[model samples]
Target chain A: MVLAAESQLRLDANWIDYLLVAFYFAFVLGIGIMARRSVSSSIDFFLSGRSLPAWVTGLAFISANLGAVEITGMSANGADYGYPTFHYFWVGAVPAMLFLGIVMMPFYYGSKVRSVPEFMNRRFGPTAHLVNAISFAVAQLLIAGINLYLLASIVEILLGWPLWVSLIVAAAVVLTYTALGGLSAAIYNEVLQFFIIVAALLPLTLVGLHKVGGWDGFTDKVAQGPGGEEQLSSWPGTALAGFDSELLSVIGIVFGLGFVLSFGYWTTNFVEVQRAMASSSMSAAQRSPIIGAFPKMFVPFIVIVPGMIAAISVQEIVEFKETGQGSVEYNQSILYLMRDLLPNGMLGLAIAGLLASFMAGMAANISAFNTVFSYDLWQTYVVKEREDDYYTGVGRVATVAATVIAIGTATFAASYSNVMDYLQTLFGFFNAPLFATFILGMFWKRMTPTAGWTGLVAGTAAAVTVWVLSEDVTGTIAIGGQGGAFVAAGAAFVVDVLVSVLVTVVTAPKPESELRGLVWSLTPRKDFHDPDEQELAWYQKPTILAGIALVMVVGLNVLFA
Target chain B: MAERKHEAGAFDIRVFIGSLLGIYGVILLLTGLFGTSDADLAKSDGLNVNLWTGIALLVSAALFVVWSRLRPVVVPDDPDEG
Candidate 1:
């Protein structure tokens, strides 16, 4: 989060580049202007009226997270930890996404639930739903603020404007498109942003590779870099995990990151899920995440490779990392490479990409924030049985309100220059517990609502306790190599399971009849995927698509290793 | 199979995305052929990156345009899904 604003690009774009950026923005606003016609109902405003095809929703799904924060953060990880950063994508994200599409989307899309919290209400009852909705709403706002801060900082660097001025300008762009066409505008722009991001970054990676001679030369330089041979392998990622034993490090990456945190974010978070939820059909809904997995897996080549190249080639970063100069931060690896490698015309496209990404991320956050606020919070609690058009009006107003609140949040994010570690630890405390409750409640019909209530509160408390014990909060103990957050995640998962199991034994579970489609064992086999309803090709099936994604990701891991 | 959404002709996302890419590709391709300098090529280590990438973009743009043209988006008759 902090990294988004940490390192300014020092752009040397010429008139041609500026012209290119102008063209890009014109397209962005044009999409919004056109999409506004499609906005006729609350469903249109909130979920694109549930009409987008699998590919559009799919690209939007990845584009939402393919923000500047992710690009910069993952690149920094590559520069600092080298090949091990691959674990974040391959080990952490792909499996969880597959699980969602194959196992979870049936329950999510088959039912009339439009949001994750709405689904929670049907399963665990109202109490758990309120907690999930409120926490999720608050989380998106804070994250949007962070995205806004990053966007404003980039705009400030580009135009030489003041921070507040840049902040409003940045906020206004997102607000306009979002307010105009609603999710349709945002999702269409996201799909375009996805292509622009790839167009901009792929060349940088290729050019940087050529500068280092080739793939072999790049690997050799990494092996000889600060982290030594460990920097070249994906396994035994001791440097990345902050674990002493190799086994512990692998466990941290697989379980803490892969199972708990990944599932927490991808399957449960409304921002990513909202994209899939907008799909045209149940089959399309499931394919959204699976389609995204293909592009998601290969993104590291363009993002991380540039960072790795920067670590070895860029003098400022090399000195800053080898010493504590702070001359050039590791997170600025992409920016520095853009400066050293790209010329005027290409430079502008990359700059446009950075802007596109920041807006895409904030749009995702703002759009999701408005959805959860309107559907789960306001409509559920305050107002009932209102006309559908009134809620569309409410959603539009929420979009504006979220943008305004996000500006305030962005100010908060800007003030805390180096608090990202602590904020991430705090996030783990929120996410890990929710995932625990969700997975437990979904699988075991015996898990009671009383258990859900206790387990969520207890799990979060346990995670916070671990954070306080670790150096991330108090300087009493030293937890290194990003291990503290992993430990906190692990603690949350374990405590939630322990508490839920205990409470379930004492309390009465929901009746079997009521838990039919929501619980795994209770759902009929045909309910998972209704082959009788649609005559689909073998290639169109979610299982075949997801299976191919899994195999390709594993192949990438092996090839890179 | 997923039920198809009726994207009104002018508002098809693929058409817009294709048009945007076509515009960029034409601009880049023109600049690569006419405006590219020796110094610019030297920066990217002797490859005419603009020219190559422009051609790639143009090819992709053609594909997107042809895709939408070949099989246009079909909207359901009663588009009242909420």
Candidate 2:
């Protein structure tokens, strides 16, 4: 009631706040300029010259994925749905990251492929490679556009700036640095952005918790609200029991999100893996995602807890919950809290962090886009004998083109109410069945190139059909929202696996000699670690670190449950 | 090889960024602790979010600095060894 009576929230940014944000932008651009000299070759531009240590690459790896959506949307989910949102991190991300580090990094890193599509080229031949490259390039462009739209909207709301102003400013800053420095620049800024984000959000959480009288008081207050105990409990009920209006079955969350989507994104998505591949050594490459897992586990506190706080503290959020009216302005949850809580200079730092996150996300997508376009598409199809500088030039040109395309896409994405949800649905269509192709291709020497193409095409078709059908279809079989996405992805994965196996059996397999280092069974059994890594303490070992991360993930699940 | 080592030890951006944040964080933390008026406290719901947040940022900066110190980039003798 008190919250309802209160007027609309407005950001009270002072000169200090503006100064802090300006400093952040200046620092990021400075880092880009500083990193420019390091990127002499296409390899350096695309892969950080493959020289960064695990820690740098590791933080950047996670930060690449921590876009504006992760900060804003996850918290919005927290305010609306509560603890189940943590599943995105714990089940949906951590295990898959560990899988990438321990099992799959050998193929990705050991084989010396520049991009994910390049890896497909080696395993599945030219057709599959082309298909993957085109789809990924298109997807990255859409994502960049959506991120631009979301960030512009947030900036407009928070700073009372026009949408076009934020869009151009963001695009200009991102394009200047990204084109100049390449992946190394993008990565360095991502690491910097990560720190800025942690710096910004940690205080918001602490202050929020303090305001609501700590965790117990916050929980009690949320329990008294509209959603009640369901919102507080991480495991709200059985798999069949619905949370609010959404049907999130255990099968859907575990199989669909945890298995298909997570594996597809973490293991195959070049944007995330490019960071790991940039590591200085094979050992560092293996350890990078593992190192990332530690911080990835704790991200929910900064992103999600703020939303939980707003659920009880803000009336607009409560009213949205009660009326079930026009879609919950869940995306505004973080900005709302900052406006309500942080002081002038601190508010600037927080906004800078938010801006940093948006830029990092866009930069990651753009850099990946450029690399995939240059290496996978241009090198393979356009001209094979061009100088390295020529490819690098193409990469720069692609970066500029990609940014323009993303800006155009952002204009289109403006029509979408929930950009984050729309993006996830888009990912479900593209990335869900990709894991099946990757998994079967890597593990099964029997899997043919034709099978790979067939599986991918058929799997994507299955996912798309389900999504389309879900709109008109209803009743026991009807899949909708996140649950629908999970089911659709699961179905696609199953279809992909079955089709690949069947096709592989029917068609002749690639020779074992040719498959060496590309397929798991045919590849040599070389140790993943270097001599120096072998000498490190047990806790420092990649396997040990990943194990620890897994245990921590399990512990968090139990604690939250 | 010597050039590589020099590159490794060269101005680490992480450390530079960390040090900057640490310095700024200290300033903000001190301001939050000592310079806050009653009106400022009222605006923030009686909790010094800035003070707490600044402390957290400082700690984060310290962690980044320490991580860089402990695992200073190691360039292999053979550039291809990685």
Candidate 3:
């Protein structure tokens, strides 16, 4: 708990602070309520009538991608890693855009499908769809809960309020906005919140930077800490750094993280895809990803700067090594910096920004959760009578159900670990398996439904086995560490694919007509055309330009290194 | 499949590069000029405000250069529209 001065801020946490928070929530809810009139059908409710302008969709796209956990987590990582972590955004996500735009987007957008799972069904089968959908939904729930839990915990820490009170209050605000708005409401609020987040963070960073001697002083200070010089300056020293990994691995991570991740995200992640479905045209949907990419490029600045500053401010860190207190918790660095540096009003603004960050993440998860549940699960299974009104109304109910589940799960998440770690672990668990399924389904023609489904279930099971076995087993035998889960899940996916492919070949091929319908979604194309013509068109000069860009970026980085 | 023809004439590569140069050039220059002296830049007192501001300038300049060079293509509006 904060001592007197911080405690006083909470006691004196006037109606004005409440009013500011309330107004933000109200604005989000207002957009949703207003949009409700336009949502006369399931597509309209889930997607927003497919009439969003490019800029609006773009802003929302970025907003949804950023959540409170991202803000807090990035800030924490920056504090630990210094400027190299920023490369994760630039080096990590940018090339991804190129790959996604040039390679994956053509196929995904070509599909004209509502969900990634639906596409899986086309390529693989119903089994693949069911496995992907369930895993995705489970992952979404875990992530949403973690995001909300973190938001609440951060608010309490800043305000010196009770944790449960903070959790309930924050949950209520997010639920109100999301419940009222759906995707349209969430995206609009995200844009508004994005600005607020930037405004709050930029000034606070300046102040924190000022408190430190600036960037050089900050880096120098961090350089002096135990192993600080080596640790602060270098990359993750893992395969992800692209140094030790094979060329294929490096290319794969870059392509997988950037292109595959983005394509998969935009195409599959219900939260983001809802924006595309809601857009006014096919072009608008395409533009949304491009628009969203702008902020993604800059997001590192928001999360990384404070963490870097905190590293410099180590003297004030009250090193818990002596007191059993400050043992370098990765996520708390940003919040700690704010508490130590900012005065009252600035602190309040920072808290608000933090909440905004958390809400953005939670809001995306919630919005997407409603989508998957409504479109894939509820509409498909429960309702044979699926009218537009019926599905739309069911979407609202699912939104509520999602919110309630998130709140309950978040309480448990907060009790165990900080929001960022919990989120990353969960993300790795779900994303690793699903990523393999989608990648194979898109690229390989022979990937049967049995293969897709087997890959998903087996991949998840492998990840779980690692999770379980890691506790008792010694080094090589156990997979119970940070990087282990990804390795496990990834291995499982490969195994599943191998088994499923064997089964598929041994069985029989589906009819050409059935294959034709799916070929559009699975293969690359400008429109629903023959796969052969599409493949030919995909070649030509664009590949040359893309190849040039890749060489230039790598060549420049290598030369500079 | 819809075929897109790339008309090099339609691109403004020069302007893009020019803008990138102007922005990043300013950032690089500012940090180099106004950022902290090399003596204090290495010390652990705190953020060398001048240094960070300088680095920020350098980064912004680099970003500008990259952005300008890779001009985003805008689709031409249909002339056949009634």
Query: TM-score for every candidate vs. truth?
Result: 0.92, 0.91, 0.73
Question: Over the stretch A225-244, how does candidate 1's per-residue lDDT look in tens digits?
Answer: 77888888899888887888
- What is the iRMSD in Å for candidate 3? 12.8
Q: Of models 1 and 3, which has the larger lDDT? A: 1
Question: Over 4 Å off in model 2, which ranges?
Answer: A1-9, A37-52, A236-248, A326-328, A472-477, A527-534, B1-4, B7-10, B30-35, B55-82
Runs of candidate 1 exceeding 4 Å displacement:
A1-9, A38-53, A162-164, A383-397, A411-427, B1-8, B80-82
For model 1, residues B2-72, the per-residue Cα lDDT tens digits are 54455446566777778877877887787789888889888888887778777878888999889888877
Of the two candidates 2 and 3, the one with more favorable TM-score, higher being better, is 2
Q: How do the residues B29-56 of candidate 3 rate in per-residue lDDT, one tens digit apiece?
A: 4543554354433331244433343354
Candidate with maximal lDDT: 1
Point to the candidate with the largest DockQ.
2
**For candidate 3 chain A, which ten residues in a row score worst on lDDT?**
A2-11
lDDT tens per residue, model 3, A364-426: 787777777777777666676667998888878877788888888887775542344455445
If you superpose only chain B onto the true chain B, what TM-score does each candidate give? 0.84, 0.76, 0.36
Q: DockQ for every model, please.
A: 0.42, 0.42, 0.04
- Which pairs clash in the backbone of model 1? B6-B75
Worst 10 residues of 3 chain B by lDDT: B73-82
